[model samples]
Target: MSTAKPSQFGVAGLGVMGVNLALNIADHGFSVAGWEFSPKRLAAVQAEKPYERLKTTGSLEEFVGMLERPRRILLMVTAGDPVDQMMDRLAPLLSPGDVLIDGGNSWFQDTQRREKAYREKGLRFIGMGVSGGEEGARHGPSLMPGGPAEAYEHIRPVVEAIAAKTDQGACVTHVGPGGAGHFVKMVHNGIEYADMQLLAETYDVLRRGLGLSPDALVNTLAEWNEGISGSFLLETTLQVLRKKDPETGKPLVDLVLDKAGQKGTGKWTVQVSLDLGVPVPSIASALDARNLSAMKDERVAASAKLPAPQAALTDEEKQHLAAWTHDALYAARVVTYAQGMRLIQAASKEYQWNVSLAELARIWRGGCIIRAKLLTPLREAFTQQPDLPNLVVSEAFAPVLTRMAPAWRRVVGTATRLGIPVPVFSSSLAYLDSYRSAELPQNLTQAQRDAFGAHTYQRRDRPEAGFVHSDWS
Candidate 1:
């Protein structure tokens, strides 16, 4: 393969994400070499008005040779088999101290396995999660990098320079060793699912229940952007609501298809939470809602077979509902984030990742999709109490939850009464209620399990260290 002058950084797979990230690196003043597997993609990139510091080559051998010693190569390819395929091609070309970074929405288990394999070969593997879509990639994205601490120094300058920054610092950090970065990213996506689903449910409630027009909704969201409810998604939601369909002169959002698409990170998050025995009701409900949304035909058929909503709210009641909905959404968001943080805590313990929850909040504050006004308080909460088990119970948030409890209940009750399926809203309330309750109905569940499957359970009257069995005839 043909060789070129060495670059300080190399990015493989010149797709949208790859190309933008390469430009971002080059914009940060680092010389970047990029590789594209397909000749067409290579030609397309070459045709672009090139950045002086950015170089492209189609050959993997030539790409590897173009990187400086102890090379740092960032792969933005598709996850799963494609990542493995790239690793196979690069393994022989990389030297002992050379670093390989996977910047994709990959499963954390795969990252752990790959890191182990690469470490055995005296190479470093970083499973990095780069958030922020095409725009963020071109400008600045939040970066979560997990690998050996020793190897981080090699790529830290480029990473920090290209990452979004807040008053705290750049939105890039060594999350932990091995798969921690991907694991955190998985939870981030799950939270995003919950966030978007909650917003959609809120929209449905306001649009259908309150009969608010798209323009009205957009104004409301824009107003919310200046308040505690402000977030990137909320800001983006305003943009979506403001768009008009050129063909029909209707709101673009109304004209768009309802079938929500997913790339499996939400599913992976739920699966990992189940594996770890962490309750992520809001996230799970969000994922389930997407799947349910996908079955559009079945839902339409069922709508014909099933009864339509009959309960209606008065104008005054609708106003009250809107006010309560704001508090409800905020409370639900708190629970959703708490649940996601809990999952990270469980994974950190199981994997000994030493993940900083405060840092997570800080890094996520700027570049990521989930960035919000709420994360500032969240970061402060975690900083104040690093080992805080749950955000709802934390000092900074508990008072907010306490105040929002009544309004949250009112919104959920109103949605239920109106026959609006607020799955995320309802699930988030359920999660909060379940978390706050000192007593639950699990005793009977334990009894049933013991009776049917001989699964021993602890007694409520005694210490939980002993698993006692009961015979119910």
Candidate 2:
């Protein structure tokens, strides 16, 4: 109730992400006024004193009052119903030209629908995808914002200031109109799932097949992080491996349950891929691997009935296989990212969002879960050829595939021989082979379809001619 007007930006919701992001804004010299529906969470925020500059209010009305005219408000609540509920409450209180930004993991379709609804009422709605977890929120994160172009100016400073920066620039962009931000974020999470699965498979092979202890595994992964396979996820895996259990005096990872949990972004990615007619075999396989892992009881029972794995590698052979496994992991990751980028490209065309593939790679190069050295080359590849068909065939990556093909094959073969389940690894290799093949066995499939369902088949001799239906005797 000072005579002064309020801050430049307001944040609604006081969850961990919400508070940290508010603090991040405050850290950059922007006064942040925040509102939380949960009194317990608001009290905790007050107790923690996360940032000195954040102003808090007890009600949404007062929070709305605590911002400047044409206010920029960031909504960090849970996605779905809660978001709609909050908007319904807040929209009535705001004047025209006031901007509300959703920084949640909302479905892109919801964003598209909401943007239109809000626009008709003279309110600007931005569906922004904020990546990087708690740590990134406190420091910096990659931000993808899509909305009406005019509304972006009001929030651009806050977005850029709180975003991670590399030598290239800040890890944030006005992606495109209508739900483009969320769509790209969804694809980002999909690639993350596949990348993590590949990492888990690599760890399993090195530990089980090569007899590497957790200590040895940590060193190996740490070493790999210094090479072409280096990444934030790989670096984090090394840290996880190094942690010891307090209760049992063993590695903490071994003590934890093997089941992985996801919040559905990966599933959405594969589903959307099907809708768009894009092949995302690596991503699909990764999602299936997680589902397969979740069937722990059935897997445990089946393990007893199945044949045991055989590990027959000598120390010399283990050394060679470890190197090959590294290359194999690199190859899989390349394919996974390539498939994800392709999905984004297809969506851009279908949605008319015109998102820049090069900018996406540049922003993802920092403050994201999937940040890696690989993105450097990826950014360059897209920059050189804006419409490059696939990343695997890019000049920067094709040589890598050529050089690693033999080793990648050996890793898959070694895993197969040892009975290690490598769904993603094998699937990625299969995708690569299928992509490069000029001829496939689908002709027989067409012939069979024609016989059973009268589906027409195109002859190779007259490929451009219309489809011809033939009766099978």
Candidate 3:
């Protein structure tokens, strides 16, 4: 009875994500011992008798003891203080070479601090980003792990065994040293926010402007999903639009509240982008859209007072509206992804992480929420030019954007005329316009700044002159 070998891996939380991940590890032929602080959760997991090789225990000491030497423990608890507290508890129990992975949405700085602290103590700490909700956790998820190279080697077998597989490879990579994994994940979520907002705007514009029923909308989106527009989120949108209320027989999404929720990652992305001087206006606009959506009562009250546009689409405009919207959606999405990737690039440069955008696109091809057909070309673009200044000018996407820009303008114009708020669409379009223009009105802004604050301005006409003050007064 006592001759059995110790579990090969350890999971120190039995939450939904933890249990599913433990089961996934066991499914990959690794014995995993799980521990949970909550007795109810522990009892619930134990009651299920999930996996024969996955053992659940309430005792923390026993859980730590069950793992083989140089233990590989994944802490899938809440982000922030809980992760630190868990680290404190596990530090005393772990050996010098034992690995502790914090698989939560923690801030990158915190991860850096923790990794530095743990390295000093001779323990390996990995800040891993796990994407693809519960189902992906049980089946396969995109795993972004950043830490010491040696520590990555320690857990590579287990991670690769359980990660989503595509033709490129497993959906897991040792992102970089320090907090690059979490940083990339944060940007991933920021892209997700922009992508979702674009979808929402598409849905709203089509539903309100074209007056299409849910069934018609589903058909339209389903056709889009078959082409280059295919993505996990769009597929999920199709599913949501197809469902009917069990009790009322009404379209389920129609009955749900208009408010949206977030878990701070999008805000963090925008915040970090500001620090890095990267413009992520698409993401920022998406975050603003969510915040505005939360003021349901204010919007409802304002609806009664504020006057909406009375302009109507012509017959030709109505006929071309859907096609225009499809192009607009795709174009805006490209811009959104461009913004997110640029932010990641800036962060990588600042942090000296050297994260490979090609590898990220490769891994995101499957399992992750933002998985899309576009990632193939995106990967190719990065592979061709690792230091590409912007995705908009890439050989793969420039012609496409040029071809689609007219339709995008039409969609934006139609939405504006109809008084529909396509925040992500308009902002992404503005970002594109600003990037392409050689001359902007910002010279006036610089002059105003100098006039007000004595800020020196660089003159374009003076070939050799440096920054100078004007006598415009």
lDDT of 1 by residue, 1-473 (tens): 54556799999999999999999999988999999999998999999997889999999998998889989999989999999999999999999999999999999999999999999999999999989999989999999999899878888998999999898899999999989999999999999999999999999989988889999998777877899999999988999999999999899999888899999999999999899999999999999999999999999999888886798896767668878888888889999999999999999999999999999999999889999999999999999998899999988899999999898888888778888899999989888888889999998898899999889899767875699777877
The TM-score that candidate 2 achieves is 0.98
Instruction: Name model 1 segments beyond 4 Å from true.
Output: 1-5
| lDDT (Cα atoms) of all candidates against the true structure | 0.92, 0.92, 0.94
Q: Return the lDDT, model 1, position 109.
A: 94
Residue 47 error, candidate 1, Å: 1.0
The alpha-carbon deviation from the true structure for residue 473 of candidate 1, after best TM-score superposition, in angstroms, is 1.7
Best by lDDT: 3
Candidate numbers, best TM-score first, in rank order: 3, 2, 1
| Local accuracy of candidate 2 as per-residue lDDT tens digits, 400-463 | 9989988989888888888988889999999999999999899899999999999899988988
In model 3, the runs with Cα more than 4 Å from the true position are 1-3
lDDT of 2 at 77: 94
**Which is better, 1 or 3, measured by TM-score?**
3
Model 3, residue 58: C-alpha shift (Å) = 1.6
